[model samples]
Target: TKVADEKTCIQFSIRRPKLPSSETHPEEGVYKRLDVAAWLHHLNELGQVEEEYKLRKAIFFGGIDVSIRGEVWPFLLRYYSHESTSQEREALRAQKRKEYAEIQQKRLSMTPEEHRAFWRNVQFTVDKDVVRTDRSNQFFRGEDNPNVESMRRILLNYAVYNPAIGYSQGMSDLVAPILAEVLDESDTFWCFVGLMQNTIFVSSPRDEDMEKQLLYLRELLRLTHPRFYQHLVSLGEDGLQMLFCHRWLLLCFKREFPEAEALRIWEACWAHYQTDYFHLFICVAIVAIYGDDVIEQQLATDQMLLHFGNLAMHMNGELVLRKARSLLHQFRLLPRIPCSLHDLCKTCGTGMWDSGYIPAVECTGHHPGWESCPYGGTVEAPSPRPPREGKKGPKVPRDGFGFRR
Candidate 1:
């Protein structure tokens, strides 16, 4: 291999496998429950793909002369620090505080009819039957709501609000985050619908719109998770389309991102006006960064249902978002990503947004996150995928932290 001086450079490439572990506990126990500590240990070692590369190169090329660059030292020191980007992120947060304050202030001045018209144009629908599940038992919850309606009414109004991708089942979950963010449920739900429509489809059956979005997602999954795609194919179209991904396309980030977190994310964009790129970048990053791990699990289980059943779990939200943002930062470095936010406006108008709401059959039928992928194929009990033949990553120890199937 050529170095700058063609010295061969002892060129060694390290393809990180997951930290090695032994699953010798053949028959005695259950699979590893989610272990954050152990997982972090593994991640610290395995995910150091960037750090290790830098360290190794410095050692090889500069030897002792590699006097650590002082300015670069902080990033180097905090490479694995948990507060990864907290300072800059906080600055974004401060800006959001001001924007949200203004949005709330503007809402204060809207007349009742004007408020109704504003939401209606945005496509919000509020009726009797569309109640929210989480709010059902909390009698005190909606006291501050500007408009009184059943959770069903609230949800349905949202469906109307974003007719491009209407009434997906899990859409309610997306609202939870926003609902948490806003003191007024009515306002929160409507704003969420507005935000969602801006990012993803909201269920319009008109002109094959839904189908196209479905197909696009399906194709992306094919590239991102072939085995998972195969599993969805095994279940037939209806199962995959109806059960699994209903809420995903409709609510977009509203469903998956929690409130405090959602506020954090939305606040940054409100300040910097960079939400569109951030959301798209994070969405795609999920596909790329976690693709291999998630795919491996689904392939092993061969159970789409199982895949979806545990969707909400497994993720460390703050950490995952950190990785997603990091990846987005990297994306900006690419020629294709964008040289400036200036180009982002032109590109969005004609590029991805104009592509219309093309849908794809996402591996659904489960919950969200990583769970059983029932759409994958018919399930065989207990063990789904074949035994580990040859694979990357250490064999996660059974009954412990490293235990990943």
Candidate 2:
């Protein structure tokens, strides 16, 4: 077996079964509702041959399991949302329903061109009034934009569902793009539901502790790929936690990725990497892409803060994704190295100094590239504490890891 000195690798043929669909299932089959076309198209883009892939099974949190040949796609359908809802709306909903009813009631008798025009009007109206809202309809506008209503519901519900952790600002930013992609309010909601399932671990209940969770996550990463953990810390700041990363944490990179790239990432996440693979990959890829760049770019404290401030807005999503995929491919071809989602998933459930209750992703600014300039005499540094008239210098809260603001 060891005839050659080349690094031994396992050629894993990944075969995922087709999932069930909302339209195709019978009354008894687990409420089938997967969007089959979407899933298949996703696979085609990944260049995977279903038959050959059957040999390389995935190791999920629940453990490695297999489904029947056409059952793959449908398995995730139950998690997708496919209809409209009124769960979280307060008042304006009635008027909106009336509006939709009017739109639907008609068009049955309209000419083809007329139908197109009607739909065009619908889209325009939704974008202008429903999404952004004008002053006249202040009553109709709530935090929930009808376009991304599910994202709001799911995110809020996630907060309520996991009372331990509540809503954060970046969450809204993340959901915005998702809403843009999913036209059906209900489907978007359910797709969001499935998306949130894998995130539950991040919101542990009662007597919850940060160290316990993060430690487990760390061990999982250590068992699978310690280099990833090490690489993240090399970023010179709090590794992935440098900018609070609220953008990547919420909406799952919807805000972090450019619009064009965001859609493709969403399709892929909804299709195969349903867990936090995309989320963690975003951070890992960021550090890797800018490791050397940061060394040269973050020349001063303001420059460093500005560097990270703009990170959310600067990621080249496509390039990073390509790198991640290439890395996975290379890892897969090894005869002995196994492909695992542990490092990736661990990140999903725990962020640096994030859980506020866990230590797994202890966020300490160690990476030299993003650290604030030493407090000596830089002009960009905060002015010397003015004579504190009986007041104390601003103090910072230190996470267990001792990271300060």
Candidate 3:
């Protein structure tokens, strides 16, 4: 098996596809507050409407300025449509405000017994997670901070709104950044809703959904980094399953990158300029760029987990993003894309293949990493408890660290 794998690896390396043209763009600075106005100005003019494409391209190349991130993220997250006029958006905002108020009122209107049931069931989990979400951020720091309470409120409302999906542990991590950016509770709630509903990465993850994504990631690894894939496959199902990337896919790298850089990465991902499955490329990029030595060292599964865990806040987000973009370009240029890959692309977004077809890649039936998805797993729902006094990271694995099962 090793000999055949090595031969296959070499064959893949020699035959790796390349793009016909490798055009490059100059590094433009962050899209500033003025740029937002410019885009909106074009939108307001009768004959001079701006294309969402230009804005998405700008964000894909250069990230948005922090000053304008709150303004821009709504469009990126699909909270606000690009075609909507200021007047229409104002009406929409009023409508949303009313809807939010109604949601809040539903909580107020719950019977004493119903309230007890909710607190015992849903709000209990939200309270525990919100306090730990981003306590280190100044906005959420200190005792009895109003922002913390606001976060709790927004999350509770979300639980009430989305009772079927309910509150999950990583949700607070996702909501905290939006709360910090948007500041207003109603807007934050709406933005979080948009994020959960629209984006591919953030979801009420099911075990099947996560396994499907890992399978796609495995195929991408096999295609782009054959030697690494061969080494992983040699280690049996544990390696090929890429369980270490669960955190990356589940939380969208919130714990992996620095706070600012994580925010930047999220916006770039939400831009939807290239592919909805860019998060998969990010998974590939991390292993490709930093874990290149995994195959060389022949690290086992646990050691690989430890190595990736230690990369939290240490990775260059910009560099990983660049590598991911390059890998996507390479995948698009492949001569005969595999059928499974085509299925992945079509499922993810518009298929990126040019033409030609090939049989699906084959693998052993010993798939691992199927314990449960980050969302589908049974987590202990801590009872409604007091917020922790000081700042601390979420109690989950940051980058596949401390995850054993």
Alpha-carbon lDDT, every model: 0.38, 0.37, 0.69
Model 1 C-alpha lDDT per residue in residues 152-241, reported as the tens digit of each score: 444655444445555545555545444443434544544554545443344433436556456545543444344555656765665446
Candidate 2 structure lDDT: 0.37
Ranking by lDDT: 3, 1, 2
Q: What is the lDDT of residue 125 in candidate 3?
A: 85
Candidate 3: misplaced stretches above 4 Å? 1-42, 46-49, 204-207, 347-405
TM-score of 3: 0.77
Model 3, 228-268: lDDT tens digits are 88888999988876767889988999889998888877877
Per-residue lDDT of 1-405 in model 2, one digit per residue for the tens? 111227532221112222223211121222222244423432433333242112111211111122221223223333312221224221233454454344334435568896576446343333343344222233234665454444444454444334344443344444444345444444433444455454432232232433333443333333334444444456644553334333343445555656556554544343343234433444444544544334433233333334444555466765655544333322222222111222433343222111232112222233367454232212222322222122222132111112112
Which run of 10 residues does model 2 get worst, by summed lDDT? Answer: 55-64
In model 1, the worst 10-residue window by lDDT is 396-405
User: For candidate 1, what is the lDDT?
Assistant: 0.38
Greater-TM-score candidate between 2 and 3: 3
Counting clashing residue pairs in each candidate, in order, gives: 61, 28, 0
